[model samples]
Target: MATTALGEYLSARRAQVTPELIGLPTHGVRRVPGLRREEVAMAAGVSVDYYIRLEQGRERNPSAQVLDALSQVLRLDDDAHLHLFRLAGLLPVPVRPAAPEQVDPQLLRLLEMWPDNPAIVLGRAFDILAGNAPAYALFDGFQQGPNLMAKIFLDPDARSFYPDWDEVARYTVAGFRLQQGRSPDDPRIRQVIEELSQASPDFVALWDKHEARGTRMTSKRFHHPEVGELTLQINAFDVRSAPGQELVVYHAEPDTPSATALARLRATATVESPQADQDPGQPASSRSSWSGSPR
Candidate 1:
């Protein structure tokens, strides 16, 4: 029997919801990892057989109300709830080819203006489309390639570069899952996922969790070889001019040790000009590329 995306997603999510999480008493040794089909059906006001059919790909279409109830029982967040709807075909999934990512000239200028803040523009597949000097300096040695996912997971020094390696890995995988949901058919996204899955066991483990969420404004600790330990808050903004592009800026609070370290790093970092033959429109200090494509 062929398994549908909806079925696979439902099964994965169901396995994550514990019986105790929904006030169901755990009396004996349970064979399954999470709530049983019958328990889920009962909680969601559906028949056991119907729920089973949903998980087995026999049931194709379910009402919005039913999906909502199942989402509640599964304890899904906003992103996960939306992802479930998309998998169930209740929400439209935009199908488009991955186009070459180009950072807008105005955005590039904006990045050049912020000498103190480390800012980078990320493509749909988390490719480093563009980065100012400070941003490049911050990422420095760990940026083995253009893709942030590859740098975080495939790079040998990534674990040491990020003190919170485990947390960073989980967050990166979850963010990638969110991007995958948005562009399910994009070859670029698929290539990145396939490559990481083959290369990193840790990535495979985190990807299996099926957590779909975008990157939020959060503080991240980085152990820069030159600057020592630094904690910076990351802020990500969607590029309204171009879809599937995000501008991520890292900043340290004023009057903090991190701020002092960042200032020192910025002061020591020299901006690199674009090559003579490089695009004139491209920012002088910005490093831009779509080099994440599979070799």
Candidate 2:
């Protein structure tokens, strides 16, 4: 029988949960890495045959109660739980083709106003749609490109730029998985996934984990070539004006060493000025360029 997406997800998640994690005894040598099929079914309050059917692609539709119980037994977090529902067709998935991402003029202006904060707009596929001067300075080590996944995974500089490279890579992969779940048919997302899977073994490993999460309010540490070490708090917001666009802002706490470093970096950074003939309403990508050495 052909494997269903829901079945694949359930199987992967189940394998990650060991019997000991859920208070099940290991009476003998176990062949499976996680709980046995019967164990999961009994723990989730479902029959062995029913749970087997669900994992075998014989049962496509599971009620909310069944999914919820299975989710609990699988020890899935909120993001992973939502991903399970999506895989089971319980949540709505976007079917429309993703439109070309364009940052709103108002949003661009807002980014420019915050010279102290590093802000950038990212497309659904993690493309760097637009960024302010400080933002460019912060990411000066990265190659000038649209897609961030390529820069993070393909570019060697990323490893050093982000001191906690392993953690960042895992977080990024999980967030990308969440985005892919929402827009499964998106060609760009598929392209990135395929390209990275072939190029980066690290990316492939994280992708197979099937973790789903989005960028949240968190602090990140960076090793800037010019500014040395700096820690910044990240805040991600959905751009209501443009669907599938996210505005990410990074700020350092006032009076802290990181804040001082950020201020110093922003002051010395030499950002390219917009051309006089260029239309102001055009997306920031066209107006500003990321070139030359880090200033």
Candidate 3:
């Protein structure tokens, strides 16, 4: 209906480019920074007039082919390429969405049965879709206002949560960036990204690098306030039937202190009940402590 918003994207990207990047000759008198529309058109195998029209918002609809050409010539990263499509009003290529990812009833039953193992099911955006009692007790703090990303990045004692805090932060940001690339328009995701960017310089630095990686499997350390540090092998798996949902299971080495700590954590729940169902019997802070237990 209306002309696209390509002008701003084009302008911002243009200013960031240097003459050397596009193989252009520069004289001492050349004042404007970055590649001109004509130079970009030449590099992209398009005419100057067409490029000008696109930049001026006169060309509202560009084919995927054309967008691809511009993307390559400008050396736009994945995020920048997607942003260009959004600004150009070209229907972005469809991507997977982390919609209602329901856990299998059988899995729920299994979790209920195992009051001893700490476990949780997470969605693509780090939403805690479901978790078990042992998991609830071990990670009690992260559960109440549970946002996995925020917990890792915003919490004051996050370093204490993970002994390898730097590595953990990098992985967390990279995972968040991957989801952001998939659904840039989600306000909640955007808000989390912005909030984290403002809150953590390390997070901001990692984001600026434009890294994107999914957390499939890793080892993590948890410094439990009660039981000291526990190292566990972390396993992450996707529910093929329910796209975008992942089951992250934590296992302590057999007969280790971590395992003993987990036993103590699990002992909190002699009988597994739905968190809401168990709340009546437990104090609010005690319930919170159960949910905030470390993985």
TM-score, per-candidate, Cα-based: 0.92, 0.91, 0.61
- Per-model C-alpha lDDT, please? 0.80, 0.80, 0.67
| C-alpha root-mean-square deviation, each candidate | 3.2, 2.8, 6.9
Which ranges of candidate 3 are over 4 A from the true structure?
A: 1-106, 273-295
- Higher-ranked by TM-score: 1 or 2: 1
Clashes of each: 0, 0, 13
Error of 1 at 72 (Å): 0.5
Tens-place lDDT digits, model 1, residues 106-141: 887788788888888887888777777788677776
Model 3 CA lDDT for position 107: 58
> Tens digit of lDDT per residue, candidate 2, span 186-291?
8888988999999999889888878788745398899998889999998999998766778889999999999999998898755542222346687654223454
**What TM-score does candidate 3 get on C-alpha atoms?**
0.61
Best by TM-score: 1
